[model samples]
Target chain A: MNLNVYLHAFTGVVKREFWRFIQQRSRFLSALVRPLLWLVVFAAGFRAALGVAIIPPYATYITYETYIAPGLCCMILLFNGMQSSLSMVYDREMGSMKVLLMSPVPRSWLLISKLLAIALISLVQVYAFLAIAWLAGVEPPALGLITALPALVLVALLLGSIGLFLSARIRQLENFAGVMNFVIFPMFFLSSALYPLWKMRESSEWLYWICQYNPFTHAVELVRFALYQQLNLQALAITLGTTLVFATLAVISFNPERTVRAAPAKA
Target chain B: MTIALQIDRVSHQYGQRVALDNVSIGLVEGQFNALLGPNGAGKSTLFALLTRLYRVQQGEIRLGDDSINRNPRALLARLGVVFQQSTLDLDLTVMQNLEYHGALHGLSTREIRRRAAEELEWLGLADRTKDKVRSLNGGHRRRVEIARALLHRPDILLLDEASAGLDVASRQAINKAVRQLCQERGLTVLWATHLLEEISLDDPVVILHRGRVLAEGIGRDVCERSDETSLDALFDRLTSAKEAHA
Candidate 1:
C-alpha cells in the first residue's frame, strides 16, 4: 500500500521484463520478422486477391499493406503477451513465480505492475515494427502515431491481462496452443485486422455486426483511428471498457484464495 | 519482543489431496527455527502459506500483528524470502539483482547500494558484486540469494532448503553466516529442510509428515522420544511410522 514500496515492486518487475527481452535477441528478431513477412510477402500476395472498398476515416484508396498495419501491431502485442505469460507459467513451474507472489505486495498491484511492464515492452516492439512498416512505405496518418500511442498501450494491456488470466487457469503449455488456435487467432482475424467491417458486410451482415461488437475490433479500431489522428468515441469506450473488464477477470482468475487444483506436469 | 510470525489452524488442499492439514506454528522474534519434513511432507506448502503464495482456506497467518492476507503489501514490506529455486536473474549482475530487490522494498538509491555492499561483504562476496549470477558457483549463488533476502532487514527470514545443493564446505559457510545473522541482528529465521544435520538441537524444529505436524518443539526434546542419538534416525522412525500407517 505504500506508494514508494509499490513503485519499488513495479520497478523490479519492469526491470526483469526488460532484461529478458534484451537478452533474448532472437525473440525480438522473430517479432519483427513475423510482421515484415505479412507486409512484404503475405500482404503483397493478397493485395490483389483482397479487395478494399472505402473504409472509415479514409478519404482515398489504401493498399492492403497500409490496411493491416494495425492488425500487425495487434499481432505483435498478442505474441509478446503470450510469450510473457508463458514465462509466468514457467516461473510457477520452476518455483520463481512463488518468489514474486510472496513479495508482501498486493496481488492486484503486483499484477498491474507486471502488466504495465509487459505493455511497455510490447509498445517498444510495436514501435519497432511501425518503424519497419514506415520504411516499407505503409504510411499511417502523420500525426496518428502520437495519438495512437495510448491506444496501442491499451491494446497491449488488454492482451497481457488475457494472457495472465489464461496462464493462471491453464496449467500446461499444450493447452495454451489450443487457446491460440481457438481464441487468439479468431479474436485477431474476426476483428477488422485483415479486412474492414464494410468489407465484411459485403460477405455477411451478421458477421459484420459480430465484428462491430467484438471488443478486439474496437481495440483495433481505436488504434486504427488514432493512427489516422481521429478518435473514435465508440472504439475508445469499447477498448477502455474491455480493458477494465478483462483486467478484473484476470485479477480474479489469479487470486490466490482460489486454490488451484494441482495437476501433473506434461510428461 | 513481538512474535515475528504466527500460523493458526491453517489447512490447504489441492482438490482432495491435502497439502497442509490443520498445520499451526509460531515463530517468535529472533528465534532461528527450522521446518523439517520428508519430500512430500508439505514443507513447501507451509512456506507457500507463510509467504502468501498459498492462501489458507481455514485459519490465519499474521506477520508482526498484521494479517498477511489482509495486508500483503504491508507484510511484504518487512519480509525477505529465498525460495527453493533461485530467483536471481542470470543475466543480471549480483549488484543489479540486489538493487532490484532493494527497490521492491522501497529503499533509496544510496541505501540500496550501501546495503548491497554491506551484504556482499558480510557473505564474503564483495569481489563478485558485478558478476552475473550465471557465472557464480552454486555455493556463491546461494550466498547471493541469502544476502538478497536480508537486504530489506525483514523481521522474518524464510529460506526454503537454501542449502540443499551446496557442498560441505559451502554448506558450513552458509550455515555459519545464518548463525551470525541470528546472533547479531536477532533476525527470526525459518530454515525449511529435510536434512536432519541442518537442525541444531538448540533451535526449535517442526517435523512435518504427509501434510501434518508430526512433532514440534526443541530439536533435542523432539528427538529424545526415540532411542536415536542423531536426528536422522529419529526422522526415519517418525516418517516410516507414518508410511506404515498409510
Candidate 2:
C-alpha cells in the first residue's frame, strides 16, 4: 500500500538475485560460454557457406560472425531468461519463493520487479559478450552499443517474460529440461539467430514463415538493427507487444491462488 | 481475552477431495496455541489459507478487524509466518537473510540492523550472523528462520511444523523460544505440529482430522471432555474413530 514498501521490497528482491548470481560462478561462465562458442567457432565454420546479403542494418556485406553477433547477443539474453526461470522453479521447490510472495506488495509488482532484475542481469552478460566480440574483431559502431542498450533490455524482458510464463505452467523442476529442448532450441534455431530468414526461405517456405512468425526473430532483428544504428519499427512493435502479452499471462498464472491450486497438496 | 486472529467457516477442496471442511477457530491474543493434526489432517492446508498461499474459498479469515479477503496486504503486513518447510536461503548469511526479510516488510537498513542484532542475540545466534545458512545445523537453521520471521515484528506469528525435522532437543528449544516470545512480547502464536510431545497440558490446542475439527480447548480440558486419560489417548481415539468411519 505504501510506496516505500514497494520500493524496499523491490530492492530486496534485486539484491538477493544478484547475490545468488554472484555466488554461482559456473552460471556466469556458462552464460558467457554458450554464445561465445557460436560467435567464435560456429560462425567461423559457417562463414563460407552462409553469405549475408547487405541487410538494412549492414550497409556493406559482413562476415558470418559479424552478422550473427547480434543474434548471439540475443541468444545470451534468451538463455539467461530461461536460467532465471529455472531458478524460480528451484526456489519454489525449495520454499524460498514463499519469502518473495509473502511480501506485502501486490503480486504483480513483485513479479515485475523480478522480471526487471532478470533483465538487468542479462544486460550485463550481453555487454560482456559484446566486449568479447569486439576483441574478436566483430565490432559494432561505438554509438551503436549505446543505442542497442534499450533494445537489448526490451528483448531481455520479452524473453524473460516468456520464460516466466513457462515456469508458471511447469509444476516440477524435472520438467524444465523438456522445456529447454522444446522451447529454447526451437526459438533459437527457428529464429534468424544463425541464418537470415531469406536463406531459410530459399531452403523451404514453411521454415521461412515459422522463422518470420517467431517473436524471437523480431527480438533478434530489433537488436540487430539497434546495433547497426538503425530502427526497425515493425520489430520494435512486435517485440514490445509480445512482451506485454507474455508478462501479463505470467503474472496471472503466478497468482498464489492459481499456483496453489496447480500444486499438489503436500499434506 | 481478545481474539487476535479468527478463521471463520473456512473450507477448501482439491478437485473432489476436501482439504479443509468448514473449519473455524479463534487464536487468543498473546497466547501460545497449538494446532495438532496428523499428516493429511488439513494442518498444512489451514496454514496455507492463513498465509494466503491458498485462497479462502468458502469462508473468511480475519486478523483483528480486517478480513483477509477484504484487505490481505494489510493483514499480511502485520503477520509473520515460518512454513512447515525451511524458507531461509541457505546461500545467504544469517544477517543477510534477516536483512532481506526486514526489507521485504519495508524496514529501513538502520532499523533492520538494530532488530537483526536484537533477534540474533535473543536467539543466541549473534555469533553465527556472518555464516551462510548452509554451514549451520538443522537446529541453527530453524533458529535463523525464527529470527528472520520476528525481524519484521508482526502482531501474530504462525509457524507450521517449525520443528518438523529437528532433533528432540532442538524441537523443545524452538518451542521454548516461541513460547517465550508469547509471554514477553504478547505476540499471538500458532504452532502447528503432529508431535504431541511438543505441546504442554495447559496450552490451548486444536485437534484437526481429515479436514475437520475433532476438538478445541485447553489441552487437558479437551482430553477430559472426550473422557480420555491423556492427550495422546485423546488424539489417538479421536483420529482413529474418523479413520474407522471412513
**Considering every candidate listed, which one attains the maximal TM-score?**
2
Predicted structure with the largest DockQ when compared to the true one: 2
Quote model 1's TM-score: 0.91
Native-referenced DockQ of model 2: 0.67
Interface RMSD for candidates 1 onward, in order: 4.2, 1.8
Question: In model 2, what lDDT does residue B208 have?
Answer: 93
Looking at the true structure's interface, with contacts defined as alpha carbon pairs within 8 Å between chains A and B, what fraction does model 2 recover? 0.66
Please, what are the lDDT tens digits per residue for candidate 2 over residues A78-189?
Answer: 9989988898888888888888777788889888989999999999889999999899999899999999999999999999999889888887889999988999999999
Tell how far residue A131 is off in model 2, in angstroms: 0.9
lDDT of 2 by residue, B83-173 (tens): 8788889999988898788888888778999999999999999899899999999999988988888888899999988999889899999
Note the Cα lDDT for every prediction shown. 0.81, 0.89
